[model samples]
Every structure is written in structure tokens, then in C-alpha cells.
Target: MASSVLPTPLLKDELDIVIPTIRNLDFLEMWRPFFQPYHLIIIQDGDPSKKINVPEGFDYELYNRNDINRILGPKASCISFKDSACRCFGFMVSKKKYIYTIDDDCFVAKDPSGKEINALQQHIKNLLSPSTPYFFNTLYDPYAEGADFVRGYPFSLREGAPTAVSHGLWLNIPDYDAPTQLVKPMERNTRYVDAVLTIPKGTLFPMCGMNLAFDRELIGPAMYFGLMGDGQPIGRYDDMWAGWCTKVICDHLGLGVKTGLPYIWHSKASNPFVNLKKEYKGIFWQEDLIPFFQAVSLPKDCTTVQKCYIELSKQFKEKFGKVDDYFNKLGDAMVTWIEAWDELNPSAAAALPNGPAK
Candidate 1:
């Protein structure tokens, strides 16, 4: 291991992180390793006044969502609890030139080689060089294409392709949607360049709110717009909404959205419902499926999809016998995935490259 060097005080241009957490102290402890080197703002949604044990040398600001809303007005939108914490935190702290938000459950992978980080920095500089303003989106897997579908998108592997964009990686959102149409077979893998990629109007990506970075100037004003009059958040899909807002803003500004370079690994807790079939109802019944069920509003006509959900729910209950049993099974699966990931991608398994303090 390298000698521990204290991260230099934050620079105006470096990425600062904001994390929203609830009652998972264990999860916070696991996240400590990645929090080093960045300004860490933790929003304790469950209890605002609760004091957390943070590692020395790390800067932390704790806030309760409830208190924020009461003090800031309904526009604070810290109401939905978990998701709201993210929204509120994004709105409040984020003082650096650039801001990066990651989920509390996520662990940062080791920092990429200096060359790769430089490449990412250059990519951002080039994207924002145009006369017009622009918004950038973070890349992630299982890319969401809005509210309708959640999966089935190609992943870019070529490192230098300028036109290629990796999911959950990095993107600039324009303020307004462009009249320009998406060119088919969206080009993949090339050196970084300025370009516009299109999705159907109103399309939202399954965003990994776990790891997103953006220019403070571009995202700051937009965050205010997302709040309800009462300070409640209007969109359940903050990342997706932010992405869409960026597109709209850029198109109107004559700037274009570009996707490219450097991949970000999302270390947040897994959503087991992602790929499970209803026939696997046994899985859902045993585990808590309320959130998954609510998050995914699949069409009824999609019988195959419906069946997959039903079966998974049934099997989950049958196999687990109790919800506790289901949780155990889920925990086992997560552990297995983590172990497998460590074996397969040793480099990505390290602390988050740029994340909140411990």
C-alpha cells in the first residue's frame, strides 16, 4: 500500500461529493475508505441530530431532511425520505466548481491511473469549450431510457472512441431538447469529441445516482427548478430528470451533449429485482419487493414480464418461508457478487476513485 498522504485542501475545480444516508451505520463504515480526499456531506434522513463517527481528517456536514424542509420551505423536497435526501443534499452543499454525488451504500474503486483521470478532465474541458452552455450526464450500467424500459442497451468498451459513451460514466446535459434526431447505430468507441446523441423525447435513463459528477454552474440552477412549491421534489428520477434538463438546456443554447471516456463503477447496494422473473415470485415474496414493485410499472400486456414478476414473488415467499429468510438469501447473493467482482475486476474493487469522506 502507498504511504497515506493527506489530500490537499479542496481546489475550486476538483470534484466534491454529497452522500445521503439513512440508518445504515454498517454501510457508512464500509463507505469510509472511498470518502477520503473529498469534501463529504452526509444527510442523515432517519435522524438529523444523530451524531456519526467519522474517520479523522475528513470533513463532514450532517443534516436532517425534515429539518431542511421545515427551514427551507417545501421546495427543499426532503420529503420522500431516502431519495429526497439525495435531492436535498444536491441542492444544499455542492459548492465546488464541480460536484459529484454517490450513494451511501456505494464504495469507491481505486483511483484510475493519472493518465485516465487526465483524459476525463480533458474530455470535460473540450465538451464545455463551445460558446453555448451544456449539461453532462454520468454513465452507469442497465442504463435507463426513461420511465418505460429499464434495460437492453449496449455497453461501450473501446477506450478512445470519441463518439462512444459508457453508461454510468459521464455525460453533459443540455437545458433544452434539440430538434435534431438521434443518428442510428449510435457510434461506439473513438477518441473524445463533441457530438449529440439522441433518445426519444421524454426518454429517461436508468440512472446510477450512486456516481454522478457535473459542473456546479450547469446543475445548480436546475436543482432549484426540480423542487415543488412546498419544497417537495417533483421528480422521482433526479438523475434522469437532470439528464433530460441538460439536453433541453444545451439544445436551446446551441451546445451539444457528448459522451465519452473513463468508466465509473457503481458500488451501491444491488436491486435484486433488476433481472428476476416473476416466476421467481419466490424471491420477491421472501424479500421486500415494495420498492421494486413501485419503481417498475411494467405494462400489463407484457405477459412474459408479468409472469416473471409473479413467479419471483411466489417463489421468494415459498423458498424463504419468512421475510427474514428472504433477506438472508439476498445477503448471500450480494456477498457472492462482491466476491466475484473482486476476483474478476480487482482494480475496480478498490475504494471509489473520487467519493465522500469517511
Candidate 2:
């Protein structure tokens, strides 16, 4: 690792980096120093008795799962899929101008050539710098073929080739599903150009939670990570499913989704069998669920995100009325999640800035 110090955030007191973890704060001990002058919210999901060590002068807050369940009440309990599901808790509680969601195992990539480039600093810079209303990561797939699009690349834009997607390069480990690895192994030591590719109006892609940043205003509408995680109906797909819903909601509101830049080094290894087993439920439901998102009815002149979600809940109830209750729970959770956001982030409500330009 390069001996680079954490860079001061441009947003200062206005940014909150939300991470969900069930482990100790060892990663923070090593990298928290880099995210100075910003608030860090750690969602300690399990073993709440084990205290997290917070070094002096670090602006941070730690919340256990029980604490969040108490705060959000029973309606929000179904949303807690696993440790990563804690992201929704962080989202509702966040009162900052921007919310950055990253995994505990993820870290900034060192410049492969041993130069003095800090990827985390670049991510913060890119995130803060005015570009689009939303950004979907366009990082290179280590397992992708020449000119091949990533797995969730929209079929709508596949033929027409839009340019709003940005490409990010990761150094060490890559974030891919287990099945992808079984087909072909990830190559080591790869660098990619940081290009922001434009996404057409109807395009959608699988958004990764490991490294995602979004404007705080979208929190109410976009913070719907549904029933997933260990011991739940499914383990993975909470973030990706939420991403699809968010992209649809964003499109309805005329929000731009940009993909690319500020590459991250994922320090974890892929386990195909375990991941494949966990992915079964989500994969089975996605084929039907995604089409529903694309075709769902929404008022063209939708005034508020809340109204849009009302239609969404109704649609969800209508579509999946019998198969299972996940959709209904999701629908109810969406409304409650917004309410929780309003209740928890009253100051944010007071700051009521106008939505970003469509």
C-alpha cells in the first residue's frame, strides 16, 4: 500500500460515508484517516456487544442492528437482509448532502506503476465534481471480452451505443458474481481508462453497492434494499434489485445515471459455489422483476417521488399478490422508508433544495 495520507473532503461537514460491517474497525483504523473532516456512519450489524474502537478526532457514529430496528420500527425489519442490508439504515439516518456507500473490505487502489495516485481521493473528487444527477459504475469487468458489455447493460441501449458511461480501473481484486469466475478466471494487474459514458433515457444496469455515491435527496426514493441476506429468502440481490428500482425511479424523475471513474481495489476473493447458491432466488425472480420495472405505469407529470412510489406499491401488490409477500413488503417499506427519512433527517427536509436539473 502507498503511504498516502487521507485527503480532506471537498464537502467537509456535508458528506457522510456509510459502511455496513459486522467485523472490527481494523479497516477503518488503516483507512479512516484518509477520509478526514467527514462523518462516517458504521452500521455494526452483528455482535453488538463487541465495541468498535474509534480513534480520537474522528467524526464517526456507530449503530447496531437492534438500535436501527428500534428507530425504524417493525415495518423496516423485513429490509434487514444481512450486514450489507444495513445500508438502508444508514441511508435513512443520513443527513448529509451526499451519501457514499462502500463495503468494509473495499479500499483505494494504488497506482499500479508505483506512482503517487490515490484512487479514493479521485473517487471523492469525481463524486463531488458536478457531472450528472446519478452515476452507475462503468468500471471494466475483468472477465469481459473485447467490446462486450457488462452483464446488466440495458438491452435498450445495447444496439444504439450511448456514451455517458464512465470506465474505472481496479488494481487488485474484481467484483464479479461467482458464476463468472467459474467460466473464466480474473486476470491480474489491469488498468482502464476513466471515461464517463452517456446512458440513454431508458437504459439500466446492475449497480454495485461496494462503491456507490449519490445525492442525499434521492435517499427517500432510492433507499429500498429489500428482503435479502443470510437466513432470509435470499442472500444477495438486495443492492442490485434496489439499483434497478432506483434507476427506474430516477428515469421517471428525469435523473441522469452516469457510469464510471475512481476505480477501487476489492480486496476479497470470489467463491463461486457459495455465491451461486446465494444468488439462486434473486436470479429466479429478476427475469420477471426487471420487465415489471420497465413497464410499470407512472404518471408522466409525477410531482413528487412519494407519489411515484404510491403507484409502485400498488403495482407491486397487483403483480406479486399471490406468489409471495416480498413485493408487498417492499411496497410498504418504500413508503415507511421515506417516512423514516423524513423523521430522521428533519434538517435535510428543512434544507429542501430543488431537485437536480433533468
Candidate 3:
């Protein structure tokens, strides 16, 4: 049930909203105004037996655990159930060129001016614009209105790299690590920073999947959330894992990852004790993981995202196998994810861009 009114000239027509949820989607009521027009790909995580209702008028297709098994078949082994990581399944099935993913708990945030912020609108703009990741711009996003690259900024890199990932910020409850959340339970985010900057080349930022958007053709194959520990319900490391791998691949492939701006109101804070237990290993391994990504160097032959990811998986197995047997399995799962991705998206795989993120 779409409105007769045409969408604005923004990147609406080509985009799809992908939400991964276990609970009812009543949170969508607040987003009805902004989300009503776009087609939704709801990846219902957790028990498929449990019914989750969708508000009327939205053009959406809901997929539960049973649907995932039916669609993906044996290749579904690569998909993580009972985890937010399952949202990557929506990315795989999507036929659209652009995808905007938001958490079910996230609500529409207001700017300091009390204006209701349209997060999707800003994400599209970020994706559509060029990102200057190769060189730092002291003046801030030069592509933004009323800003320009300052003196001594290299002219060769000014054209910027094609943005593959657009990472959005959060308001209200900040996305803190388990340790931080455990230490400070009363902390709430109140400041709203209005800026978008490219994650510099060779720099790895912790990517939160909550309010994220990406070009399907460019970096979709590399967007696997993860295949954590043989279907065991793992911790909050899924997006971080994807982010690290995607950043490494993007840096090698000469692409940009942008962040900041288009903040969302993150309402719910999960149990810190639960998060700490799940992310305890993640907290320990994170220190070592950052350096691994920073040191990652892909071969020139690894042109495609799939190839680069496969190489990355090998690196994990080779370097981190002795630390824990899990890396070896995670490495294989990465390859399996690519195989599944190619099986699902044949055309995109066959014609995968080797030159640029476009």
C-alpha cells in the first residue's frame, strides 16, 4: 500500500530497508512517515514459530528461520541464527543496488533544533556522495555545502574514492563495549554531532551495524555478518567482525568507508552482565584483532571482493589458528559465505566490479 505521492529526488527508488528483529516491529509506528514508501526486507531472527506483526501499508517481505532454511537450503549453515548477524541474509536476497539497515529498537532522533531527523535520507546522501579517505581534509566533508579542501590537500586524491559503506552514529543510548556498559550503566548520549567524514585508509573503525547503509554491488559480497561458532549464540562481535573484514578489503580495493551524522535514537540498552559474558573473549581478542587488520595486505591478484575476503579468511587461519581452533572454522565459514553469496547473486557475482567500488 504505497502513497500516490512520488518520492523525493533522493536515492529512495533504488533503496530497500532491511531490519533484523526477534520482537514485534511496533517500533515502526514512529518510522511510518519515513519508511512507508520503501520496500522492507524483514529478517525475523530467533523462533520462527513466534509471530511478529508488521504495521499495514508498508511494502515488505518478512523471512523467518524456516524461510531462511527453505531459501538457502544447506548453504544456510553459513547463516547465524538467533543473532542480529542474520540481517546479512537480507543483504544477500536483496535485488536493489542500495540497502539501509537499522535496528528494530532504534527510533527517529531529533536534531538539536528539535527537528525530527530522517536517518535514511542522510545515509543515502552519504552513499551517493564521494568519500575522501585517501587524504584527510581538515575543513571536513568538502563535498558538503559551504566546505572545501584546504591548502596542501593533494589534487590527485581530491576526486576521492567511491564510498562503499556509510556508517551512521547513535543518540540516547550509545553503542558502548561490554566493559564500558558494565562500568557505566547510567550513561546516556545527549550530544548530536553534525558531520560526516570518511574513515581514512589503513584505519579500522569499529563498525556498528545498527544504522548502516551500503552499495550492494560494490561491497555486498564482503558484508557477511559472520559465521560464529557452529550455531552457538555468540556475542556482540558480529558487526565488529564484518566491519574489520570490510575495512581491510575496502582499503585493499581502494574504496572508502564513511561515518558520523544521521544519528538514530538507540532506546534499549541490553543487560551489561549478559553482554560482558558473551563479549569477554571479544574484549580480549579485540586488542590483537585490530593489529591483524592493520597489518593485512592483500595481493594484487585479489581483485574481486570475494577473492579478497577468501584471502582474508586464509590470513585468519594462518595467523590465528594456534590461538584458538575457532579462527580456522571462522575462516572456512568466510569462504562458505562467499560461496553462498555467489549462489544467490549470480549476476552480481559474475559482473562484480574489479576496478572501483562503483
Q: Go through the candidates in order and give each one's C-alpha lDDT.
A: 0.37, 0.63, 0.88
- Candidate 3 C-alpha lDDT tens digits along 202-253: 8999999999999888899899988653355357899999999999888888
TM-scores for candidates 1 onward, in order? 0.45, 0.79, 0.95
Model 3, residue 182: distance off in Å is 1.7
Error of 3 at 334 (Å): 0.6
Top candidate, metric lDDT: 3
How do the residues 7-126 of candidate 1 rate in per-residue lDDT, one tens digit apiece? 653342355556666654354444444445456666665556666565566665666766566644633432335443244344444455555555544432323332223222333443
Q: In candidate 2, what are the lDDT values of residues 1-358, reduced to their tens digit?
A: 9969865557777768788887766665556546656788988876767787766667888888668778778655644745487677887787776677778777666554655445445555544433333333254321122334557756454332111112244556666666776676665546655454434456667877787766666534565676666556666687786777666666676554545566667777757788888787777888888888878767665445555666777787788767777667666766676667667776654544224223
Ranking of all predicted structures according to lDDT, beginning with the best and ending with the worst: 3, 2, 1
lDDT of 3 at 295: 91
Which stretches of candidate 3 lie above 4 Å from their native place? 1-9, 356-358
Model 1 has a clash total of 72
For each of the candidates, give the backbone clash count: 72, 16, 0
Better by lDDT, candidate 3 or 2? 3
